[model samples]
Target: MVDLASLPPQLRRAVDDEMRRLRAGDGVLYGDMTSEEAHDLESADGRALPPDGALDRFIAHATVPPADVAASDLAGYTLVGVVPEGPGLDGPWSSVKRVYRRPDGVLVMLHEWAYVAEGGGVLGVRELMNASVRHGTARCPAQFAIRRAPTGQTVSELRWFTDAKVFTLSVAQDVLADGGKDHGKAWMLRLAEAIE
Candidate 1:
């Protein structure tokens, strides 16, 4: 009953593959029950396999999921990609993220990093302030930079650093019929302030 169709293409495909394998092998919880319901059974009957998900602290190392944010906050964007790295052998030790794009083709990439972790911290705020200056970043509450992207499109980036996490909003310049960095910056700032 999982709505696999609603997931992003990559995630859908991956989950579809896993569901098939599980169904074929009868290895996963399969029934009408919700995951929480199934998990209670899973936990009580546990054989010490492995956790199916990353710890919340580990997930906190990445950008907030698009689903967690209000739809209007996205300014009409839809999530198109996800990079999930969880607590596992080959997956990353921290951080997962999503990519989103709007109808007019504005692309936004949000990335997060934890300042503290169990072993050590992930390094760098994208070398902010240092590199922000090169891109002419200005600070109000945080640094805002309009820099040229590789494709020559401009990016309006808003970044903030805190005791526990670093959050960034990078929006491809030009949005709405009004257009240009001004609109994009307004959009980015609105999204940034709205997030918390």
Candidate 2:
């Protein structure tokens, strides 16, 4: 179980509710895998999907998407790849990633991971940074936070943290910065919002 006492009240409640739903089998698994397929994949490459609540919980707490972006803008994204432990990434955790391509050539990916056994907990900022800045969620506005590379890399990430996992909105820096900081922030926020 997660150390509920360590979390803020609002986040704590969300975690508890999700745990209950997970126990009740009220979770959503994205990829369309049959029992045999899931089992076979698990055997071939150690990538077992989390029972259900991982993605569901993130969606439940995610910020609402901006109204300016159209539904069609979020369409056509699909689960293009999954990396399980062992062969692909040499860890006990597994990740599922989806890709969306807009007509204008902007690409966005939403990725989530969970542990094979105990799931994950909300990580502290220092711990998250030590873990290569991937484990924790952003507590800032939009239910997410953004970090730009100091060296001017053409990629910016907007991350959302849930008690058990992290979701990221990665966009082309040029496309996001086309207008300016406000434009990029708004674009990233819109993508983060449409993730669910």
| Model 1 TM-score on a 0 to 1 scale | 0.47
lDDT of 2 by residue, 33-78 (tens): 2355334323322242342453343334333211122342355543
User: At residue 163, what lDDT does model 2 achieve?
Assistant: 46
**Candidate with the greatest lDDT versus the true structure:** 1
Candidate 2 scores a C-alpha RMSD against the true structure in Å of 15.5
lDDT of 1 by residue, 99-194 (tens): 566676566666555434324443232212322211114332355554442344444556665444456666655332255354554565567655
Off by over 4 Å in 1: 1-68, 85-93, 118-141, 149-151, 174-182
Query: Cα lDDT for residue 120, model 2?
Result: 41
Instruction: Give the worst 10-residue stretch by lDDT in candidate 1.
Output: 22-31
lDDT of 2 at 190: 58
Question: How many backbone collisions does model 2 have?
Answer: 1
In order, the Cα lDDT scores of the candidates are 0.45, 0.40
